[model samples]
Target: METLANLESFVRSAETGSFSAAGRRLALTPAAVSRNVAMLERNLGVRLFQRSTRKLTLTEAGERFLASIGGNLDALQAAIAAMSNDHGEPAGVLKVSLAPSFGVAYVMPLLPDFLQRYPAIRPEWHFENRAIDLIAEGFDAAIGGGFELAPGLVSRPLAPAHIVAVASPAYLRERTLPADPAMLNVMDGIVMRSGRTGRTRHWTMRDAAGNEVATTMRERIVVSDPAAMREAALLGLGVALLAVPDVLPWIERGELVRVLPRWYADAGAISLYYPTRTLMPGKTRAFIDHVVEAFRRDGLAQRLAGSLGL
Candidate 1:
Protein backbone atom coordinates (compact mmCIF):
# COMPACT_ATOMS: atom_id res chain seq x y z
CA MET A 1 0.00 0.00 0.00
CA GLU A 2 1.19 3.53 -0.79
CA THR A 3 1.97 5.72 2.21
CA LEU A 4 0.35 9.16 2.67
CA ALA A 5 3.85 10.70 2.55
CA ASN A 6 4.33 9.40 -0.99
CA LEU A 7 0.95 10.79 -2.09
CA GLU A 8 1.79 14.19 -0.63
CA SER A 9 5.19 14.21 -2.31
CA PHE A 10 3.60 13.40 -5.67
CA VAL A 11 0.91 16.10 -5.41
CA ARG A 12 3.33 18.82 -4.33
CA SER A 13 5.74 17.95 -7.10
CA ALA A 14 2.94 18.09 -9.68
CA GLU A 15 1.68 21.43 -8.42
CA THR A 16 5.09 23.09 -8.17
CA GLY A 17 6.51 21.37 -11.26
CA SER A 18 9.79 20.66 -9.49
CA PHE A 19 11.03 18.18 -6.93
CA SER A 20 13.13 20.87 -5.26
CA ALA A 21 10.13 23.12 -4.68
CA ALA A 22 7.96 20.28 -3.40
CA GLY A 23 10.78 19.19 -1.10
CA ARG A 24 11.11 22.71 0.27
CA ARG A 25 7.40 22.80 1.10
CA LEU A 26 7.41 19.35 2.63
CA ALA A 27 10.65 20.01 4.58
CA LEU A 28 12.45 17.16 2.79
CA THR A 29 15.50 17.04 0.55
CA PRO A 30 14.81 17.13 -3.19
CA ALA A 31 16.32 13.63 -3.59
CA ALA A 32 14.02 12.29 -0.89
CA VAL A 33 10.89 13.81 -2.49
CA SER A 34 11.97 12.36 -5.86
CA ARG A 35 12.42 8.93 -4.31
CA ASN A 36 8.96 9.01 -2.70
CA VAL A 37 7.39 9.93 -6.05
CA ALA A 38 9.43 7.21 -7.77
CA MET A 39 8.22 4.65 -5.25
CA LEU A 40 4.61 5.69 -5.83
CA GLU A 41 5.02 5.44 -9.62
CA ARG A 42 6.50 1.94 -9.31
CA ASN A 43 3.68 0.82 -7.05
CA LEU A 44 1.04 2.17 -9.42
CA GLY A 45 2.87 0.83 -12.50
CA VAL A 46 2.55 4.19 -14.28
CA ARG A 47 4.71 7.19 -15.04
CA LEU A 48 3.37 10.36 -13.48
CA PHE A 49 5.85 12.95 -14.71
CA GLN A 50 8.02 13.58 -17.76
CA ARG A 51 11.43 14.56 -16.42
CA SER A 52 14.04 16.84 -18.00
CA THR A 53 16.94 18.84 -16.61
CA ARG A 54 14.98 22.09 -17.10
CA LYS A 55 11.49 21.22 -15.85
CA LEU A 56 9.05 18.48 -14.87
CA THR A 57 5.86 18.15 -16.87
CA LEU A 58 2.87 16.12 -15.73
CA THR A 59 1.87 13.13 -17.83
CA GLU A 60 -1.79 12.55 -18.69
CA ALA A 61 -2.15 10.08 -15.84
CA GLY A 62 -0.54 12.54 -13.43
CA GLU A 63 -2.95 15.26 -14.44
CA ARG A 64 -5.93 12.95 -13.96
CA PHE A 65 -4.79 11.82 -10.50
CA LEU A 66 -4.10 15.36 -9.39
CA ALA A 67 -7.51 16.52 -10.50
CA SER A 68 -9.16 13.63 -8.68
CA ILE A 69 -7.42 14.15 -5.35
CA GLY A 70 -5.99 17.70 -5.15
CA GLY A 71 -9.12 19.44 -3.89
CA ASN A 72 -9.78 16.96 -1.08
CA LEU A 73 -6.19 16.37 0.00
CA ASP A 74 -5.67 19.51 2.03
CA ALA A 75 -8.97 19.20 3.89
CA LEU A 76 -8.17 15.63 4.82
CA GLN A 77 -4.74 16.56 6.14
CA ALA A 78 -6.11 19.57 8.00
CA ALA A 79 -8.77 17.39 9.62
CA ILE A 80 -6.21 14.93 10.88
CA ALA A 81 -3.97 17.72 12.13
CA ALA A 82 -6.96 19.19 13.97
CA MET A 83 -7.72 15.94 15.79
CA SER A 84 -4.80 16.73 18.11
CA ASN A 85 -4.77 20.30 19.38
CA ASP A 86 -0.97 20.30 19.64
CA HIS A 87 -0.70 19.58 15.89
CA GLY A 88 -3.63 21.71 14.68
CA GLU A 89 -1.41 24.09 12.73
CA PRO A 90 -2.09 24.02 8.97
CA ALA A 91 1.16 23.58 7.06
CA GLY A 92 1.35 23.51 3.23
CA VAL A 93 1.95 25.48 0.07
CA LEU A 94 -0.81 28.01 -0.63
CA LYS A 95 -0.99 29.11 -4.27
CA VAL A 96 -3.01 32.24 -5.00
CA SER A 97 -3.60 34.63 -7.92
CA LEU A 98 -4.23 38.35 -7.64
CA ALA A 99 -4.28 41.49 -9.75
CA PRO A 100 -0.87 43.09 -9.65
CA SER A 101 -1.82 46.62 -8.70
CA PHE A 102 -4.45 45.74 -6.11
CA GLY A 103 -2.32 43.03 -4.63
CA VAL A 104 0.65 45.34 -4.21
CA ALA A 105 -1.28 48.26 -2.86
CA TYR A 106 -3.66 46.57 -0.40
CA VAL A 107 -3.20 42.83 -0.11
CA MET A 108 0.58 42.86 0.11
CA PRO A 109 0.51 45.15 3.12
CA LEU A 110 -1.46 42.61 5.12
CA LEU A 111 0.71 39.62 4.26
CA PRO A 112 3.37 40.26 6.88
CA ASP A 113 0.80 39.96 9.62
CA PHE A 114 -0.71 36.85 8.06
CA LEU A 115 2.69 35.20 7.86
CA GLN A 116 3.38 35.99 11.48
CA ARG A 117 0.17 34.32 12.56
CA TYR A 118 0.36 31.30 10.26
CA PRO A 119 4.07 30.55 10.28
CA ALA A 120 3.55 27.04 9.00
CA ILE A 121 1.92 28.20 5.74
CA ARG A 122 3.99 28.79 2.62
CA PRO A 123 2.40 31.17 0.13
CA GLU A 124 3.06 31.25 -3.60
CA TRP A 125 1.33 34.31 -4.98
CA HIS A 126 0.97 35.05 -8.69
CA PHE A 127 0.17 38.59 -9.77
CA GLU A 128 -1.87 38.68 -12.98
CA ASN A 129 -4.80 40.41 -14.61
CA ARG A 130 -6.19 37.60 -16.73
CA ALA A 131 -8.97 35.36 -15.48
CA ILE A 132 -7.57 32.02 -14.27
CA ASP A 133 -9.16 28.58 -14.19
CA LEU A 134 -8.53 27.95 -10.49
CA ILE A 135 -8.90 24.18 -10.38
CA ALA A 136 -7.50 23.55 -13.85
CA GLU A 137 -4.53 25.78 -13.10
CA GLY A 138 -3.95 24.38 -9.57
CA PHE A 139 -4.42 27.70 -7.76
CA ASP A 140 -5.62 27.50 -4.16
CA ALA A 141 -7.37 30.88 -4.36
CA ALA A 142 -7.77 34.12 -6.33
CA ILE A 143 -8.86 37.71 -5.68
CA GLY A 144 -10.75 39.76 -8.27
CA GLY A 145 -14.12 41.07 -9.37
CA GLY A 146 -16.59 39.75 -11.94
CA PHE A 147 -15.43 36.13 -11.77
CA GLU A 148 -18.10 33.77 -13.04
CA LEU A 149 -18.89 31.29 -10.29
CA ALA A 150 -17.34 27.96 -11.29
CA PRO A 151 -18.64 24.53 -10.22
CA GLY A 152 -16.91 24.04 -6.86
CA LEU A 153 -15.70 27.48 -5.79
CA VAL A 154 -16.93 30.11 -3.36
CA SER A 155 -16.40 33.90 -3.04
CA ARG A 156 -16.39 36.19 -0.03
CA PRO A 157 -16.94 39.90 -0.60
CA LEU A 158 -13.98 41.99 0.58
CA ALA A 159 -14.78 45.49 -0.62
CA PRO A 160 -16.74 47.46 -3.21
CA ALA A 161 -15.31 47.63 -6.74
CA HIS A 162 -16.09 51.17 -7.75
CA ILE A 163 -14.66 53.25 -10.59
CA VAL A 164 -14.67 57.04 -10.97
CA ALA A 165 -13.23 59.65 -13.33
CA VAL A 166 -10.14 61.50 -12.11
CA ALA A 167 -7.37 63.82 -13.35
CA SER A 168 -4.24 65.52 -12.05
CA PRO A 169 -4.56 69.02 -10.65
CA ALA A 170 -2.10 70.37 -13.23
CA TYR A 171 -4.14 68.95 -16.10
CA LEU A 172 -7.42 70.36 -14.78
CA ARG A 173 -5.86 73.76 -14.17
CA GLU A 174 -7.29 76.58 -16.34
CA ARG A 175 -9.63 74.00 -17.92
CA THR A 176 -13.32 74.42 -17.32
CA LEU A 177 -14.62 71.76 -14.92
CA PRO A 178 -17.37 69.68 -16.42
CA ALA A 179 -20.86 70.35 -15.01
CA ASP A 180 -21.82 66.81 -15.95
CA PRO A 181 -20.24 63.70 -17.45
CA ALA A 182 -21.48 64.83 -20.89
CA MET A 183 -19.10 67.82 -20.91
CA LEU A 184 -16.16 65.35 -20.80
CA ASN A 185 -16.67 64.83 -24.55
CA VAL A 186 -14.77 68.08 -25.25
CA MET A 187 -11.98 67.29 -22.75
CA ASP A 188 -8.71 65.50 -23.31
CA GLY A 189 -9.62 61.98 -22.22
CA ILE A 190 -7.14 59.30 -21.17
CA VAL A 191 -8.89 55.94 -21.37
CA MET A 192 -8.08 52.27 -20.89
CA ARG A 193 -8.36 49.46 -23.40
CA SER A 194 -9.95 46.43 -21.79
CA GLY A 195 -7.69 43.37 -21.56
CA ARG A 196 -10.65 40.98 -21.59
CA THR A 197 -12.81 42.74 -24.22
CA GLY A 198 -9.87 44.16 -26.26
CA ARG A 199 -11.83 47.37 -26.72
CA THR A 200 -11.74 50.80 -25.12
CA ARG A 201 -13.56 50.86 -21.79
CA HIS A 202 -16.66 53.02 -21.46
CA TRP A 203 -18.19 54.21 -18.20
CA THR A 204 -21.74 54.85 -16.98
CA MET A 205 -21.51 56.78 -13.71
CA ARG A 206 -24.23 56.94 -11.04
CA ASP A 207 -24.86 59.91 -8.76
CA ALA A 208 -26.32 60.46 -5.26
CA ALA A 209 -29.74 61.37 -6.65
CA GLY A 210 -29.90 57.94 -8.32
CA ASN A 211 -29.28 59.52 -11.76
CA GLU A 212 -26.92 57.85 -14.21
CA VAL A 213 -24.50 59.60 -16.57
CA ALA A 214 -22.61 57.76 -19.26
CA THR A 215 -19.32 59.41 -20.20
CA THR A 216 -18.51 60.25 -23.84
CA MET A 217 -14.98 61.57 -23.68
CA ARG A 218 -12.80 61.72 -26.81
CA GLU A 219 -9.92 59.29 -26.39
CA ARG A 220 -6.86 61.53 -26.42
CA ILE A 221 -4.93 58.58 -25.01
CA VAL A 222 -5.85 54.89 -24.80
CA VAL A 223 -3.82 52.91 -22.27
CA SER A 224 -3.75 49.20 -21.64
CA ASP A 225 -3.28 48.96 -17.88
CA PRO A 226 -5.00 50.79 -15.04
CA ALA A 227 -1.64 51.98 -13.72
CA ALA A 228 -0.73 53.43 -17.12
CA MET A 229 -4.04 55.23 -17.35
CA ARG A 230 -3.46 56.76 -13.91
CA GLU A 231 0.08 57.74 -14.95
CA ALA A 232 -1.14 59.33 -18.16
CA ALA A 233 -3.65 61.42 -16.23
CA LEU A 234 -0.89 62.40 -13.76
CA LEU A 235 1.26 63.61 -16.65
CA GLY A 236 -1.45 66.17 -17.37
CA LEU A 237 -2.66 64.18 -20.37
CA GLY A 238 -6.44 63.90 -19.71
CA VAL A 239 -9.21 62.69 -17.48
CA ALA A 240 -9.45 58.89 -17.05
CA LEU A 241 -11.89 56.54 -15.40
CA LEU A 242 -10.08 54.48 -12.74
CA ALA A 243 -10.79 52.09 -9.91
CA VAL A 244 -10.71 53.44 -6.37
CA PRO A 245 -8.29 50.80 -5.12
CA ASP A 246 -5.78 51.63 -7.87
CA VAL A 247 -5.96 55.42 -7.45
CA LEU A 248 -6.91 55.80 -3.79
CA PRO A 249 -3.36 56.47 -2.62
CA TRP A 250 -2.85 59.12 -5.28
CA ILE A 251 -6.17 60.75 -4.46
CA GLU A 252 -5.25 60.78 -0.77
CA ARG A 253 -1.94 62.47 -1.58
CA GLY A 254 -3.77 65.03 -3.75
CA GLU A 255 -1.92 63.81 -6.84
CA LEU A 256 -5.33 63.19 -8.42
CA VAL A 257 -8.81 64.55 -7.89
CA ARG A 258 -12.14 63.00 -8.76
CA VAL A 259 -14.18 64.48 -11.62
CA LEU A 260 -17.98 64.45 -11.32
CA PRO A 261 -17.44 63.72 -7.63
CA ARG A 262 -20.79 62.23 -6.86
CA TRP A 263 -20.85 59.90 -9.84
CA TYR A 264 -19.22 56.45 -9.82
CA ALA A 265 -19.68 53.12 -11.52
CA ASP A 266 -20.38 50.23 -9.19
CA ALA A 267 -18.33 47.51 -10.82
CA GLY A 268 -19.41 45.00 -8.16
CA ALA A 269 -17.60 43.59 -5.14
CA ILE A 270 -13.95 42.68 -5.13
CA SER A 271 -14.17 39.23 -3.64
CA LEU A 272 -11.71 36.64 -2.26
CA TYR A 273 -12.44 33.51 -4.25
CA TYR A 274 -11.31 30.00 -3.44
CA PRO A 275 -12.35 26.36 -3.42
CA THR A 276 -15.52 25.48 -1.51
CA ARG A 277 -15.77 27.01 1.98
CA THR A 278 -16.36 23.63 3.59
CA LEU A 279 -13.15 22.23 2.16
CA MET A 280 -11.06 25.40 2.45
CA PRO A 281 -7.62 24.77 3.90
CA GLY A 282 -6.61 26.61 7.06
CA LYS A 283 -4.04 28.81 5.30
CA THR A 284 -6.58 30.16 2.81
CA ARG A 285 -9.19 30.59 5.50
CA ALA A 286 -6.71 32.60 7.59
CA PHE A 287 -5.92 34.86 4.62
CA ILE A 288 -9.60 35.54 3.94
CA ASP A 289 -10.23 36.49 7.55
CA HIS A 290 -7.15 38.72 7.69
CA VAL A 291 -8.16 40.61 4.53
CA VAL A 292 -11.75 41.10 5.66
CA GLU A 293 -10.62 42.40 9.02
CA ALA A 294 -8.19 44.82 7.41
CA PHE A 295 -10.91 46.19 5.16
CA ARG A 296 -13.27 46.53 8.08
CA ARG A 297 -10.61 48.33 10.14
CA ASP A 298 -10.13 50.91 7.40
CA GLY A 299 -13.83 51.22 6.57
CA LEU A 300 -12.76 50.44 3.00
CA ALA A 301 -16.28 49.65 1.89
CA GLN A 302 -17.42 53.20 2.65
CA ARG A 303 -14.41 54.74 0.92
CA LEU A 304 -14.80 52.68 -2.23
CA ALA A 305 -18.59 52.90 -2.33
CA GLY A 306 -18.88 56.68 -2.96
CA SER A 307 -19.07 57.74 0.68
CA LEU A 308 -16.02 60.01 0.53
CA GLY A 309 -16.34 63.78 0.60
CA LEU A 310 -14.91 65.74 -2.32
Candidate 2:
Protein backbone atom coordinates (compact mmCIF):
# COMPACT_ATOMS: atom_id res chain seq x y z
CA MET A 1 0.00 0.00 0.00
CA GLU A 2 1.23 3.54 -0.88
CA THR A 3 1.80 5.78 2.13
CA LEU A 4 -0.56 8.72 2.45
CA ALA A 5 2.34 11.17 2.52
CA ASN A 6 3.72 9.82 -0.76
CA LEU A 7 0.26 9.82 -2.28
CA GLU A 8 -0.12 13.48 -1.32
CA SER A 9 3.15 14.46 -3.01
CA PHE A 10 2.22 12.52 -6.16
CA VAL A 11 -1.17 14.22 -6.30
CA ARG A 12 0.27 17.71 -5.79
CA SER A 13 3.00 17.17 -8.41
CA ALA A 14 0.42 15.94 -10.90
CA GLU A 15 -1.88 18.91 -10.25
CA THR A 16 0.84 21.60 -10.29
CA GLY A 17 2.69 20.21 -13.34
CA SER A 18 6.15 20.25 -11.71
CA PHE A 19 7.85 18.82 -8.68
CA SER A 20 9.35 22.21 -7.83
CA ALA A 21 5.94 23.86 -7.83
CA ALA A 22 4.51 21.00 -5.77
CA GLY A 23 7.37 21.45 -3.31
CA ARG A 24 6.51 25.13 -2.99
CA ARG A 25 2.90 24.23 -2.22
CA LEU A 26 3.95 21.59 0.32
CA ALA A 27 6.75 23.70 1.85
CA LEU A 28 9.21 20.94 0.90
CA THR A 29 12.34 20.82 -1.18
CA PRO A 30 12.22 19.54 -4.75
CA ALA A 31 14.54 16.69 -3.76
CA ALA A 32 12.12 15.63 -1.06
CA VAL A 33 9.19 15.71 -3.50
CA SER A 34 11.18 13.62 -5.97
CA ARG A 35 12.01 11.15 -3.24
CA ASN A 36 8.36 10.83 -2.29
CA VAL A 37 7.30 10.15 -5.86
CA ALA A 38 10.12 7.64 -6.35
CA MET A 39 9.15 5.83 -3.18
CA LEU A 40 5.53 5.66 -4.34
CA GLU A 41 6.61 4.36 -7.72
CA ARG A 42 8.76 1.72 -6.10
CA ASN A 43 5.83 0.56 -3.97
CA LEU A 44 3.50 0.42 -6.97
CA GLY A 45 6.19 -1.20 -9.15
CA VAL A 46 5.43 1.10 -12.09
CA ARG A 47 6.87 4.44 -13.20
CA LEU A 48 4.34 7.20 -12.49
CA PHE A 49 5.85 10.15 -14.35
CA GLN A 50 7.98 10.22 -17.45
CA ARG A 51 11.01 12.45 -16.75
CA SER A 52 12.22 14.94 -19.34
CA THR A 53 14.40 18.01 -19.49
CA ARG A 54 11.58 20.36 -20.45
CA LYS A 55 8.49 18.85 -18.83
CA LEU A 56 6.98 16.13 -16.66
CA THR A 57 4.24 13.94 -18.08
CA LEU A 58 2.13 11.17 -16.56
CA THR A 59 2.52 7.66 -17.93
CA GLU A 60 -0.48 5.57 -19.03
CA ALA A 61 -0.13 3.47 -15.89
CA GLY A 62 0.11 6.61 -13.75
CA GLU A 63 -3.04 8.04 -15.33
CA ARG A 64 -4.94 4.85 -14.66
CA PHE A 65 -3.72 4.77 -11.05
CA LEU A 66 -4.70 8.40 -10.48
CA ALA A 67 -8.17 7.74 -11.85
CA SER A 68 -8.59 4.82 -9.48
CA ILE A 69 -7.26 6.58 -6.36
CA GLY A 70 -8.56 10.12 -6.78
CA GLY A 71 -12.05 9.50 -5.44
CA ASN A 72 -10.67 7.49 -2.54
CA LEU A 73 -8.32 10.28 -1.61
CA ASP A 74 -11.17 12.75 -1.61
CA ALA A 75 -13.22 10.43 0.55
CA LEU A 76 -10.38 10.11 3.05
CA GLN A 77 -10.11 13.90 3.27
CA ALA A 78 -13.84 14.18 3.91
CA ALA A 79 -13.65 11.54 6.62
CA ILE A 80 -10.89 13.43 8.40
CA ALA A 81 -12.88 16.65 8.18
CA ALA A 82 -15.91 14.94 9.65
CA MET A 83 -13.80 13.72 12.55
CA SER A 84 -12.39 17.21 13.14
CA ASN A 85 -15.85 18.75 13.06
CA ASP A 86 -16.90 16.52 15.93
CA HIS A 87 -14.24 18.07 18.17
CA GLY A 88 -16.15 21.40 18.23
CA GLU A 89 -13.05 23.56 18.72
CA PRO A 90 -11.13 25.41 16.08
CA ALA A 91 -7.60 24.01 16.20
CA GLY A 92 -5.01 23.65 13.43
CA VAL A 93 -2.74 25.74 11.24
CA LEU A 94 -4.85 27.79 8.84
CA LYS A 95 -2.93 28.72 5.71
CA VAL A 96 -4.20 31.82 3.89
CA SER A 97 -3.09 33.61 0.71
CA LEU A 98 -3.74 37.33 0.14
CA ALA A 99 -2.73 40.21 -2.10
CA PRO A 100 0.49 41.77 -0.78
CA SER A 101 -0.76 45.36 -0.73
CA PHE A 102 -4.13 44.66 0.85
CA GLY A 103 -2.59 42.28 3.36
CA VAL A 104 -0.05 44.91 4.43
CA ALA A 105 -2.43 47.87 4.44
CA TYR A 106 -5.41 46.19 6.05
CA VAL A 107 -5.20 42.53 7.18
CA MET A 108 -1.78 42.29 8.84
CA PRO A 109 -2.47 45.18 11.24
CA LEU A 110 -5.49 43.39 12.73
CA LEU A 111 -4.03 39.87 12.90
CA PRO A 112 -2.46 40.27 16.32
CA ASP A 113 -5.84 40.92 17.89
CA PHE A 114 -7.38 37.97 16.09
CA LEU A 115 -4.51 35.73 17.15
CA GLN A 116 -4.99 36.79 20.75
CA ARG A 117 -8.68 35.98 20.61
CA TYR A 118 -8.15 32.57 19.02
CA PRO A 119 -5.18 31.21 20.95
CA ALA A 120 -5.81 27.64 19.84
CA ILE A 121 -5.60 28.39 16.13
CA ARG A 122 -2.40 29.19 14.26
CA PRO A 123 -2.15 30.97 10.91
CA GLU A 124 0.40 30.60 8.11
CA TRP A 125 0.00 33.38 5.57
CA HIS A 126 1.34 33.82 2.03
CA PHE A 127 1.23 37.41 0.74
CA GLU A 128 1.61 37.80 -3.02
CA ASN A 129 -0.23 39.17 -6.04
CA ARG A 130 -0.31 35.76 -7.74
CA ALA A 131 -3.38 33.55 -7.98
CA ILE A 132 -2.59 30.13 -6.46
CA ASP A 133 -4.45 26.86 -6.72
CA LEU A 134 -6.02 26.53 -3.27
CA ILE A 135 -6.30 22.74 -3.06
CA ALA A 136 -2.99 21.95 -4.73
CA GLU A 137 -1.26 24.70 -2.74
CA GLY A 138 -2.77 23.66 0.59
CA PHE A 139 -4.24 27.07 1.41
CA ASP A 140 -7.22 27.21 3.73
CA ALA A 141 -8.45 30.50 2.27
CA ALA A 142 -7.57 33.41 -0.02
CA ILE A 143 -8.51 37.10 0.07
CA GLY A 144 -8.75 39.04 -3.19
CA GLY A 145 -10.73 41.60 -5.19
CA GLY A 146 -12.54 40.45 -8.38
CA PHE A 147 -15.91 39.71 -9.97
CA GLU A 148 -14.94 36.63 -11.98
CA LEU A 149 -14.29 33.81 -9.54
CA ALA A 150 -12.55 30.49 -10.12
CA PRO A 151 -14.72 27.47 -10.72
CA GLY A 152 -15.33 25.07 -7.76
CA LEU A 153 -14.43 27.65 -5.13
CA VAL A 154 -16.69 29.31 -2.55
CA SER A 155 -16.35 33.11 -2.43
CA ARG A 156 -17.89 35.33 0.24
CA PRO A 157 -17.87 39.11 -0.08
CA LEU A 158 -15.81 40.91 2.53
CA ALA A 159 -16.19 44.51 1.35
CA PRO A 160 -16.54 46.68 -1.76
CA ALA A 161 -13.38 48.31 -3.19
CA HIS A 162 -13.48 51.74 -4.85
CA ILE A 163 -10.82 52.76 -7.37
CA VAL A 164 -9.76 56.37 -7.98
CA ALA A 165 -7.37 58.29 -10.17
CA VAL A 166 -4.83 60.18 -8.09
CA ALA A 167 -1.69 62.22 -8.48
CA SER A 168 0.64 64.17 -6.26
CA PRO A 169 -0.16 67.85 -5.81
CA ALA A 170 3.17 68.64 -7.48
CA TYR A 171 2.37 66.42 -10.47
CA LEU A 172 -1.06 68.04 -10.84
CA ARG A 173 0.60 71.45 -10.73
CA GLU A 174 3.02 70.42 -13.49
CA ARG A 175 0.46 68.86 -15.86
CA THR A 176 -3.10 69.75 -16.80
CA LEU A 177 -5.57 67.26 -15.41
CA PRO A 178 -7.44 65.44 -18.17
CA ALA A 179 -11.07 66.60 -18.12
CA ASP A 180 -12.21 63.64 -20.23
CA PRO A 181 -11.19 60.00 -20.85
CA ALA A 182 -9.99 60.81 -24.39
CA MET A 183 -7.42 63.22 -23.01
CA LEU A 184 -6.03 60.42 -20.80
CA ASN A 185 -4.21 58.97 -23.83
CA VAL A 186 -1.81 61.90 -23.80
CA MET A 187 -1.24 61.89 -20.02
CA ASP A 188 1.62 60.10 -18.33
CA GLY A 189 -0.08 57.49 -16.18
CA ILE A 190 1.63 55.01 -13.89
CA VAL A 191 0.59 51.54 -15.04
CA MET A 192 0.78 48.41 -12.91
CA ARG A 193 1.88 45.07 -14.36
CA SER A 194 -0.40 42.55 -12.75
CA GLY A 195 1.08 39.14 -12.17
CA ARG A 196 -2.39 37.65 -11.76
CA THR A 197 -4.02 39.25 -14.80
CA GLY A 198 -0.89 39.15 -16.98
CA ARG A 199 -1.70 42.60 -18.42
CA THR A 200 -0.98 46.24 -17.76
CA ARG A 201 -3.45 47.97 -15.47
CA HIS A 202 -6.23 50.03 -17.10
CA TRP A 203 -8.24 52.76 -15.44
CA THR A 204 -12.01 52.25 -15.38
CA MET A 205 -14.71 54.89 -15.06
CA ARG A 206 -18.43 55.41 -15.24
CA ASP A 207 -20.21 58.45 -16.70
CA ALA A 208 -22.90 60.48 -14.92
CA ALA A 209 -25.54 58.33 -16.64
CA GLY A 210 -23.84 55.14 -15.30
CA ASN A 211 -22.19 53.99 -18.53
CA GLU A 212 -19.05 52.02 -17.83
CA VAL A 213 -15.90 52.79 -19.78
CA ALA A 214 -12.31 51.61 -19.62
CA THR A 215 -9.28 53.57 -20.78
CA THR A 216 -5.79 52.19 -21.27
CA MET A 217 -3.46 55.10 -20.78
CA ARG A 218 0.06 55.43 -22.07
CA GLU A 219 2.45 54.22 -19.40
CA ARG A 220 5.19 56.49 -18.09
CA ILE A 221 6.25 54.12 -15.33
CA VAL A 222 5.16 50.50 -15.20
CA VAL A 223 5.54 48.99 -11.74
CA SER A 224 4.57 45.66 -10.21
CA ASP A 225 4.26 46.64 -6.57
CA PRO A 226 1.39 48.85 -5.40
CA ALA A 227 3.48 50.45 -2.65
CA ALA A 228 6.16 51.38 -5.17
CA MET A 229 3.53 52.79 -7.52
CA ARG A 230 2.13 54.97 -4.71
CA GLU A 231 5.61 56.19 -3.81
CA ALA A 232 6.33 57.02 -7.44
CA ALA A 233 3.08 58.97 -7.66
CA LEU A 234 3.98 60.85 -4.47
CA LEU A 235 7.30 61.84 -6.05
CA GLY A 236 5.38 63.36 -8.99
CA LEU A 237 6.41 60.68 -11.46
CA GLY A 238 2.87 60.22 -12.87
CA VAL A 239 -0.80 59.82 -12.12
CA ALA A 240 -1.91 56.48 -10.65
CA LEU A 241 -5.14 54.57 -10.53
CA LEU A 242 -5.19 53.33 -6.93
CA ALA A 243 -7.48 51.68 -4.48
CA VAL A 244 -9.13 54.37 -2.36
CA PRO A 245 -7.87 52.82 0.89
CA ASP A 246 -4.26 53.04 -0.33
CA VAL A 247 -4.13 56.74 -1.28
CA LEU A 248 -6.51 58.20 1.31
CA PRO A 249 -3.76 59.07 3.79
CA TRP A 250 -1.79 61.02 1.20
CA ILE A 251 -4.96 62.78 0.16
CA GLU A 252 -5.62 63.78 3.78
CA ARG A 253 -2.04 65.05 4.16
CA GLY A 254 -2.44 67.14 0.99
CA GLU A 255 0.39 65.19 -0.60
CA LEU A 256 -1.88 63.73 -3.30
CA VAL A 257 -5.09 64.90 -4.94
CA ARG A 258 -7.95 62.81 -6.25
CA VAL A 259 -8.29 63.50 -9.98
CA LEU A 260 -11.48 63.27 -12.03
CA PRO A 261 -13.42 62.22 -8.97
CA ARG A 262 -16.76 62.29 -10.77
CA TRP A 263 -15.54 59.72 -13.32
CA TYR A 264 -14.19 57.08 -10.93
CA ALA A 265 -15.88 53.68 -10.90
CA ASP A 266 -16.57 51.01 -8.29
CA ALA A 267 -14.01 48.29 -8.88
CA GLY A 268 -15.90 45.43 -7.27
CA ALA A 269 -16.13 43.51 -4.01
CA ILE A 270 -13.21 42.07 -2.07
CA SER A 271 -13.88 38.43 -1.26
CA LEU A 272 -12.66 35.57 0.91
CA TYR A 273 -12.39 32.36 -1.09
CA TYR A 274 -11.79 28.71 -0.25
CA PRO A 275 -12.14 25.33 -1.90
CA THR A 276 -15.67 23.98 -1.62
CA ARG A 277 -15.52 21.15 0.88
CA THR A 278 -18.18 19.13 2.68
CA LEU A 279 -16.95 20.06 6.17
CA MET A 280 -14.95 23.22 6.87
CA PRO A 281 -12.39 22.82 9.63
CA GLY A 282 -12.81 24.75 12.87
CA LYS A 283 -9.65 26.80 12.39
CA THR A 284 -10.74 27.96 8.94
CA ARG A 285 -14.22 28.85 10.20
CA ALA A 286 -12.86 30.85 13.13
CA PHE A 287 -10.49 32.77 10.86
CA ILE A 288 -13.34 33.60 8.48
CA ASP A 289 -15.48 34.90 11.36
CA HIS A 290 -12.62 37.02 12.64
CA VAL A 291 -11.93 38.47 9.20
CA VAL A 292 -15.62 39.21 8.62
CA GLU A 293 -15.85 41.08 11.93
CA ALA A 294 -12.64 42.98 11.23
CA PHE A 295 -14.06 44.16 7.90
CA ARG A 296 -17.30 45.18 9.57
CA ARG A 297 -15.40 47.31 12.08
CA ASP A 298 -12.74 48.72 9.78
CA GLY A 299 -13.85 48.19 6.22
CA LEU A 300 -12.19 49.70 3.17
CA ALA A 301 -14.86 52.42 2.89
CA GLN A 302 -14.36 53.52 6.50
CA ARG A 303 -10.59 53.39 6.10
CA LEU A 304 -10.84 55.56 2.99
CA ALA A 305 -12.97 58.15 4.80
CA GLY A 306 -10.70 58.32 7.82
CA SER A 307 -7.55 58.51 5.72
CA LEU A 308 -8.97 61.16 3.41
CA GLY A 309 -10.25 63.31 6.33
CA LEU A 310 -13.83 63.00 5.12
The candidate maximizing lDDT is: 1
What tens-digit string does per-residue lDDT give for candidate 1 at 199-304?
A: 9988888887778888899999987888899999888899998889988888989999987787788888899888774445666677777888999998877777
lDDT score, residue 184, model 1? Answer: 86
What local distance difference test score does each model get? Answer: 0.83, 0.78
Query: Candidate 1 regions off by >4 Å?
Result: 5-78, 84-86, 277-279, 307-310
Top model number, TM-score: 1
Per-model RMSD to reference: 5.2, 4.7
Tens digits of per-residue lDDT, candidate 2, 201-289, equal 78667665676767767789999877888999899888888877677778778888877766665777678998777777778877888
Question: What TM-score number comes out for model 1?
Answer: 0.77
